[model samples]
Target: MSPAETALPDLVDSHCHLDFPDLVGELPEVIARARAAGVGRMVTICTRLKNEPAVRAIAEAHAPVFYAAGTHPMSAAEEPLATVGELVALARHPKFVGIGETGLDYHYTAESRAIQQVSLRLHIEAAQETGLPLIIHSRDADQDMEAILAEGMARKPYACVMHCFSSGPRLAEAALEMGFTLSISGIAAFPKSQELRDIFLRTPLDRLVLETDSPYLAPPPHRGKRNEPAYVAHTARALAPLFGLSLPEFAARTTANFDRLFPRAAGAQQAA
Candidate 1:
């Protein structure tokens, strides 16, 4: 049988994008499949400030779903910078467990470097104030990413996670040193990702979490297909042995890690 069909233990998809067109209309079915595959919980990340309402509603409508919203790095320049006050207010909602999937992304929009940096700092402030973990998306700009995160953290420490962590070892170490978490995505499960998997292996077990990054980065047997929370199993299975744990143990470890970083999620309200 293919990796996709491998049995999975109960898990939480620490990050996903159920608000995007790819999953929104089919949400109920999408969620059902996720549950069936042992993906018992998910945090749907909203990349744009403008779409917070829609994303929030998705969380409210589904009992197992929680949501977070912030300006994505790639869209930072096009959108207005976020403020700490605004984000803190949003965090009042019980299900708003995380802040910004906000970080540097020079891969596609290097021209917006200045604007992105400004936006990123603001999101950092928001996370600092709200006391919610910042969900970062670092890409080709590892140097700047490391510098800025360190600078902000120096001023005031805050919880953070390197969402979809796929950068070089330097950035990984920087994030890890700062007491931040590194999320494991399908990229870690890809056959050619020995280097990436090595980074995860070196990370402290307590600081690792799992995510699907749904509608993208599908794991083996599902790679190149639209990813969903259900496929998180394949990625989890790939890393379990590397950690010398059974799939159930790895799932529990990651899910417990998620609960620590996102306390609001475990006890979120049933409806909005």
Candidate 2:
């Protein structure tokens, strides 16, 4: 075996889209590659609730994969609003690990902002009710995101993670204040992400996790290529140094953070 692969530590890809077209066609090979890279577990997200069955099937078929489902912010206007009961019902499945890939994204669908807010709150309620962590996707809507999340916390506390977090320091601080985690994606490894790196540097290591957001942010050495769970190892290698730890140490720490956020997946690991 290659030296790096031989010594690879177990790592979790906290967020990814294994059900998406780019990765789904090659699911078995993609999953095998992820395991080969020491990405021992992956949480494949279903952005639109209608696709939950297919996403769940992917998880059911793969021992190392788990899934979460919700309506994405950009699609909030077009899709039926998800109910707390509906999301909670999905949580009955042993492999369902979280409540969303939901939140606001004003970058492209600003006109749907209001509906997005409603959708986010509904997901929050689901998270609150299920005791599952909320997996958020915020983009160019930090202020409202902060307010709404804080508002939810005021009504009732719940666990949450800002998935593929590339927001400003203020949002990061707000999330941390609410005891939420910030998931690092390949964007943090880009040459131009020093500012983002500094934000992560300032954040507590325990309050962070790693994700590929694959089929999207591919990190270095493969930045322009289609990303998969296997590439999350590249991101881990790139960010470990920032936290003053070796790859294995960083991997262990982030995996622990992911476990804390997604206990259901951790439970699966223990069973195996």
Computed on alpha carbons, the lDDT of every model, listed in order, comes to 0.90, 0.93
* Deviating ranges (above 4 Å) for candidate 2: 1-6, 270-272
Q: Write the per-residue lDDT of candidate 2 for residues 128-162, one digit (tens) a residue.
A: 99999999999999999999999999999999999
Model 1 lDDT per residue over 1-272, tens place: 65633765869999999998889889989999998888889999999988999999998889999999889999988888888788888889988999978998899999999989998898899888888999999889999999999998999999999999999999999999999999999999999999999999889999999999998999998999999999998899889999999888899899888889998876443321
Model 2 clashing residue pairs (backbone): none
Q: What is candidate 1's CA lDDT for residue 132?
A: 94
**Which candidate gets the maximum lDDT versus the true structure?**
2
Q: For every model in order, what is the number of clashing pairs? A: 0, 0
Cα deviation of 212, candidate 1, in Å: 0.6
RMSD over all Cα atoms, model 2: 2.0
Model 1: residues >4 Å from true position, as ranges? 1-8, 267-272
> Candidate 2 versus the native: TM-score?
0.96
Q: After best superposition, candidate 2 residue 144: deviation in angstroms?
A: 0.3
Q: Estimate the lDDT of model 1.
A: 0.90
lDDT of 2 at 268: 56
